[model samples]
Target: MTEQTTGRLKVRLVDGLLILIMAVLAGCGLIYEYLLSHYAGRVLGAVEHAIFATIGIMIVAMGFGAFAARKIKDAFSGFAWLELYICFIGASSILFIAAAIGFTFHLPQLISDTFNLPADVLPRGGWVEQLHQIARYLPYVSAACLGFFIGIEIPLIARVREALYQKHLTHNAGTVYGADYIGAGIGAALWIGWMMSLDINQAAVITASTNLLIGFLILLLFWQKIRWRLLLTACQLLMLAFVIVLSAYGQNWMNSFTDMLYRDQVVLQQQTQYQQIVLTERNLQLNNNPTQTSVLQLYLNGRLQFSSMDERIYHEMLIHPVMASAPKHDSVLLIGGGDGLALREIFKWPVHSVDMVELDPMMISLFKQPRQFLPIRLAKQVIELNANSLSDERLNLMYADAFNQVDQLVAQGRIYDVIVVDLPDPNHPDLNKLYTNHFYTRLQQLLNADGVLVVQSTSPYHAQDAFIAIGKTIADANFSAVEQYHQNVPSFGQWGWSVAVKQGLPVSERLKHSLAAQTMPVIKTQWLTWPIVLASFNFPQGFYKNYVNIKVNRLGSQQLFNYHDQAWRKQQGMVNLNSNQQISP
Candidate 1:
């Protein structure tokens, strides 16, 4: 005995449960990232502002939670009840949100709008309004509860340590931090592997159980008397169990309703770590064989990414200009694009070898196996992805790394005769870095003097300013000049692309349209004419010109958290569905 009451053996239990509770608290951050993106995509008319709007609100709420922790007068036994409350909040979160959106917003919109019902009678315009309400405020609530608990645990564990033996706050903090990091790692793995598959209801149940069990363990270790507060906690959980069952059942109706609202000829839907991958088809071109039908499209995170049919416009734009300008085509590197469209273009050249490096093994697996992709071409040579391998000698030409991922390759001093960057929009800051001044300068360093780099900028017509900003961003990065172009693709609406070189002109500007379009295995975009090329750079004076002031950084920066990404779909005038819940974050 270190001259304390029998109260001191409580140390081990409090420390262990502190680890567990903090694990649950840290869960909020990762889960927030995934759910914020998912919910924003689900809602119609959501802007780039919403991602920032939600994140800011949640962090503020966490501060509020830390402030509120000062008011809790009772310690130890009373604090144990807070763990139970945390469990309840964590478990019910996904269910409450998904069910609310699925039923309240999505279902009624499809059914009522299709049948033509009165808005006064039902929650018309569906759950987008409701989900907006949730996304705007609910995150704050989540942070408050999670943060309050976390703040208290720091002091509670400190009290336990002081009660046992004298250790400085710094030493205790390190131990707590070590345990928290390890627990968060475990939780992240479980979240990706298991929670991703479970429906919103089941996800809640699992989350709730993890929290409640942790709470029970905490109480058992610290509090000897099982009081009224513990009983209340049990009863609250039983009621939540009932809510979970109802919400899960409601979501069944929601899924069908959401499908009809979008009217997707949905080909595939998978939640990968990268983003939500959805493949869809529209029978626009009528054909004799019903089996061999219309165009197939790919959507990532609710935005139209690419279509298999006219994707040639985007891919050809990315490939041909660079290939024609490059000194040699001995070796090539492709990243992120596991779709095999970019690979099809590379094979068109007389290249010695090509390395298709993709981060997600799933994308490569899909291309390699016909059963997985169903008619999609396989990759040339799918290699395991790692940033360290960028220094490898084999690659003479590279495509696939998004602007954010390009930094590592740039730092490695990997040079290429030609570089093709075909990533999703700079709708968020993370994607925007690749288009920034710093990234372009790094890109210029990676390209040989004669090397030409072609970047797939967004639609010149829809997002001309952002497109111009990209051009200027490269100009700021020390590239002498930037070339721009636009092409019509049904799946992507009106899209734009640009090519930048260190010391040479793009082949299109220098040479005439002398090379004839040859028939290829995939679609050939020989239709790329001088008229289209000239018109691409011709922007109306009315276009927004904020590109002059924009600043781009390498990391801990913007996250492209501004440029509204779902632009094309909004341009196409697409609509979305219903939702579940009373609680907002």
Candidate 2:
């Protein structure tokens, strides 16, 4: 080959490698951003807020990183070292955050064990609490560090491309940026398509391993251009070994850390596409003997769904009131009760068919056909707990988001005589949509003219405004009548529900007449009685008097979620209740 031709080919090869490196690094960087955000949401209570905050912090840090990359005098060495740092930080970030949060969570127990102090008697709301609060936010710090390194990548790649060509190419920035954007798009697609459902540690290891491989390629292909070839290669090998170990055992370590966050024994835990499902058991002891009745509690994304001991109270109240009040019980629609506990109650009525729209099919599978991963005894208990309602011949299960599924039912003109919304509290914006007046309005259209619709409103005492707003939203959906009721369930203190009818006598009056006429006797319930049902409709005077500023949860407004989050934070002491700047629950 001629001298000029050889020189041009060399430049082309170097340019291609640099662009490829930029693309791969971009993909890795995007995955790291998602990883940190997802972990933050899992640890923090507010999933949406945590995700947005983490991404925002990372993006701002990236801008600062891009600006700061001008400080690197040796582009080749700087880019290589930056990849190493990114690899180490990305691989270890989640584990480090988990360890910090778990240590802080278990600190009280550690102190009590060391000092022989009673658990409740230990000091609180001091340095320990401060440590807990600080630990909760470690994800943001990790995010900033990772994002800073990721930000330097494109600038270094551009510099290397220019140096390889022996001239500053006008298209350098545009070309490198195009590759980076395309790689990031691919990363996003991978995350949504596959990585989202993988074990989080596994995802981290895979991303880090990709970074390590890219760094190795750079060190090998540009040995003379980059300094510290031997050290970088050694570091690459070491990081590869570390990633392998993490792949083998990191999820176990993560589970141990996660177990520290819970008070009871975490018997079963799974990360599904929708949310984290944790099943915990509290073995009660009376007179130093283990009692036969152990409490099995189900939690979705760290929020308690139900405790087996008092779930009857919650479920009976959620189901029986609306069932009795409805003029007919031949058809029913249930939204978001994948556990089948509510379905078990629905079966008590004389419903000919039940159509359930649950967002998570894994939840349905877990309850319907308990997986072998669950302990055999516990699996049997789960099936028995729900009476295998998921597998019943009357059930027509639709594994889809209720927000969209409700619309389809409306389009099909499929109306239900009774509809039960057994969804979770509106902790995330996606869930907040379900609480909007638009959602309730669509649901109103899906209900028979005289049918009853009931929702599992949040706690009456803990989140009174949120509960009231839910009732108001349903009322605003053009229901003919609406009534709010509460029952003190031990698991969830003072839980509430809202019942509405499209056009008929109100649910409470219908329920009262049903009780008086002896027509509701067919419903055999363990925890529900006539007086309890009737009295649930009664609230302490003035409970409904202070809602002057409450607004109906409209589309995109998320008022119900705001109320619930504010109230919950106040209850958890996360909000400063005594300050003038404090938001009212």
Candidate 3:
């Protein structure tokens, strides 16, 4: 009975040690992903190289470490030392990757981005090779140190159990593996949930510091000897210094590198499980500051989500027609349209209450900032809520679930009198889904009686097939439809919109009738004249032939995406993404 009790105690201790090692290893994977995305845009570049490189390096390194694990049979109790070494290696790997790419491509672009210059002026694209070199070298170093310690620690843990409490090696290994699983899960959860909320440099420091603390704690348990306590304290102090110094100086290094790559100011930054969100601020006008104006703007990923100079087109198109079509425009509900442009237009009407439910909080924070175009008045109207919230009796739902076409609201049973599908073209699968027959049918359930739905399809000419598909989908959903074009935005070529309603009426009638009077508080300031209303319907012969007969059974959503992608490939200095083919404003 005494022997069995002692043996069980040994197994528990071994398990604890193994858990610590696994936590450190799992952190490596999390930190690696976070850093890479921050350093490079997730969508662009050769991510395949980094991913394949990480896996290849880790597996190969793990194999070598596994062999080392078997060889260090007698010296296995030194798992504490292995933990300290692996933590250092994992933590330092960040700087290794950063330094490699930092000066090469990223920093130069950051500086250049501060000013707008002619094309062929920016650095050419062969920076991937330098990144490949970094990826090739850094992962091997991390894997060698991480894999070696991880492999060696398991056997060391088993040996310690066998010696300290006389547990068998097999029992020790099994017990330790269980702890390993639990610790890895915890590490993964923590990184995704909280660590990812930080910038890459911050995430790296936090993750590394965590490992160091845990490593010291494990040492305290295993190293009962007085002499080893000094070593543990010294190691902890070293890690503390590492985190503090890196925290202080690391950001400057990172931003410098990023500036070079993007040729823009790397402003607001965060790492998520999937990607890095960077907000860049470019001083469009340096010599003179525009008073009562926003000189700086924010960009997400690489796309220009918002600008201070003007967003009249984005908002006017999204809101004006929806308001023009809706019953009374009393209470409003906006979902996922966080740029505040849609809300800006909504504020133009005598809206009693407005609720905007944006999914990403980070984006909202950026929205609250004062831009020349994004006034506090626009941001104030929002009753900010998440998309999954319920609509009250007051909500005249205004839906804009069209980012990359992955409209979560489409599936969620709800209807609005005014639905504005201001989404990107059918580029990715998610964006394409919003243009599908299934999505329109889902949207049908949410419309109020006699409600009007405005969908921003791609160009009426360039992406004519995609534009046609949107109309067909709305028709398939059993809604009477009318299509229009307005080129208010120069960024996107001529933009398009499809208005689908429960009742068939010439869109021009509803649009004309819905104009706000001069007496209205919001409308007193701006122009919503009947001239703009007349111009919206004056579609050319080309747009008419484009949407001739697009049907559900024959859905080629790719036509729009392909056209846009090809145009993008053409790369004649600019492409319009914000407004459709024919925009009206």
> After TM-score superposition, what is the CA distance of residue 439 in candidate 3 from its true location, in Å?
4.7
User: Residue 469 in candidate 1 has what lDDT?
Assistant: 61
Compose the digit string of candidate 2's lDDT tens values, residues 157-257: 88888888879799988999999998998899999889988878889989998888888877877789888888888888888888889989999998888
Which regions of candidate 3 fall more than 4 Å away from where they truly are?
A: 1-85, 94-102, 106-168, 171-173, 217-240, 251-280, 284-294, 325-328, 350-353, 362-415, 422-439, 456-476, 482-498, 506-585
Tell me the whole-model lDDT of each prediction, alpha carbons only.
0.55, 0.85, 0.54
lDDT string, candidate 3, 1-585, tens digits: 699798787666665555565555555544544444433323232233434555555556666766787665444335656666766765666566656544544433454576765544654334543443354355445545565555665566556656655545656666666665665677667767777667667676666676677667666665763245676678778877877888898767765655544435555555544344555445555468553322233444445544444445555665676676666665454645555556656665766765455446545544444232234533332223112122323333333334322245445544455655655455444345656666676666667777777777666655556566666667778776655555444445466677777775656666655443332223422444446646866776665564455445223454434444444434422322111111111
Runs off by more than 4 Å, candidate 1: 1-56, 62-81, 104-207, 219-224, 229-262, 265-267, 281-289, 321-336, 373-415, 513-523, 526-537, 540-585
**What residue pairs clash in candidate 2, if any at all?**
none
- Weakest ten-residue segment in model 3 by summed lDDT: 576-585
| Candidate 2: residue 118 Cα off by (Å) | 2.3
TM-score against truth, every candidate = 0.69, 0.95, 0.66
What local lDDT score does residue 342 receive in model 1, on the 0 to 100 scale?
71
Counted clashes in each candidate structure: 32, 0, 38
Question: Can you give the lDDT of residue 397 in candidate 3?
Answer: 33
Best by lDDT: 2
Report the alpha-carbon TM-score of model 2 versus the true structure: 0.95
Worst 10 residues of 2 by lDDT: 576-585
Count residue pairs with overlapping backbones in model 1. 32
